[model samples]
Target: MTMSSGNGISFYMPRYDFTVRARWLERNARLIGVLKAAVPTQAIFSHVVVSGQTVGAVTRIRYDGPGVMVPRVFGSVFFYQPSQKINLCYGEITESATVNQFAEVIQEDLDALRDLGSKVWADTVANPVRHVVQVNIQEW
Candidate 1:
């Protein structure tokens, strides 16, 4: 299943999952909006995947965009499992059953998802890591 926002951000997940948690996604539209604005550009594609009991919300640059080479970026608060603590990019958030409440919890985390998105973009483009190499000759 897929849901597209007016600003060119599209979300995808399994049809069964969507049927089960459609309301959750609907209630957290603001969170999706936050993700849409987290990146520098307006073209983003997000896919939600279910692994075991955890759900991950992954974002990537659109293929038609300038950042087509940019790797996928995940929301800071990606994993969501009822009755289990949701892990953040840097830490963990308290457990909750409803997705709406989860959004509230994330909001209390000072917009961690947005921060993570920006940081990933900066690290990938603005300030990429540089590797230095040194070689030494040895006699055996």
Candidate 2:
């Protein structure tokens, strides 16, 4: 089945192990928000960007839409705003879950997200790891 919720598209998989559930957030970034990399590798992860909206304590990013509770998220996760840089060391890193209607990220988490963004930017084309590179936000 397919459905649209919280700035993203949701494809629900009937079974957990028997199927795959996928949620794709368009460039909106608000749905999935930029998050700390959870690839089972990559040490020192952190980030959180809150778009133009300023959320004081906690901000709701993604909710019960599509892969909200599926696949499980672990380690330091980030929820960053689109078109913004990540800051991995912006704030204290932690975990949170969705409740009632949507998943919420605290301010500290947002700060951390910013730190990760900076790190990613620095480690990537911004610093030229292997070859000279340039980062264009609008183009990306």
Candidate 3:
């Protein structure tokens, strides 16, 4: 799946049924192989604030060489209480990369997710989002 861009960020994040079919199994294999193959290249740190107070920074994301490799499927379901409508979506149809360059990718994706959380509305379902939590990437 090709990652979508928003709030000036772009990267793949999959959720829903397809996540059950393919991506779920693939990531685990790497949990054994690639994760061990890679070593902590560096420590991760960042400072975040919501409404003008310093929250925290650099939460200890161990940059192990590169991220894992795996296939993925993703989607999001949004419920808008005001509009009385539900938005069901699936996209970015592709397997993820190996040698993920994770230190960079994680920062990018987390930002995108946070941005999305801000823009959408809440309704019956909790605006649920789930994607392949890629532990490794090969840059395929």
TM-scores, all candidates, are 0.21, 0.24, 0.18
* Global lDDT of each candidate: 0.28, 0.26, 0.24
Instruction: Give the top-scoring candidate (TM-score).
Output: 2
Q: Show pairs that collide, candidate 1.
A: none
Candidate 2: segments with Cα more than 4 A from true spot: 1-102, 130-140
Leading candidate by lDDT: 1
* lDDT of model 3, residue 11: 23
**What is candidate 3's local distance difference test score?**
0.24
Tell me the tens digit of each residue's lDDT in model 1 across 1-140.
23364322222212211111111233344444444444332212122222212233332322221111111122333223233222223223233332322122223333433443234334333455722211111111
lDDT of 2 at 68: 31
Candidate 3's TM-score? 0.18
Ranking by TM-score: 2, 1, 3
List candidate 3 stretches off by more than 4 Å: 1-60, 75-90, 94-140
Candidate 2 C-alpha lDDT tens digits along 94-132: 434321111323333444334434444354325655221
Query: In terms of lDDT, which candidate is stronger, 1 or 3?
Result: 1
Q: For model 3, where is the 10-residue window of minimal lDDT? A: 15-24
All predictions: root-mean-square deviation over Cα?
18.6, 14.4, 16.5
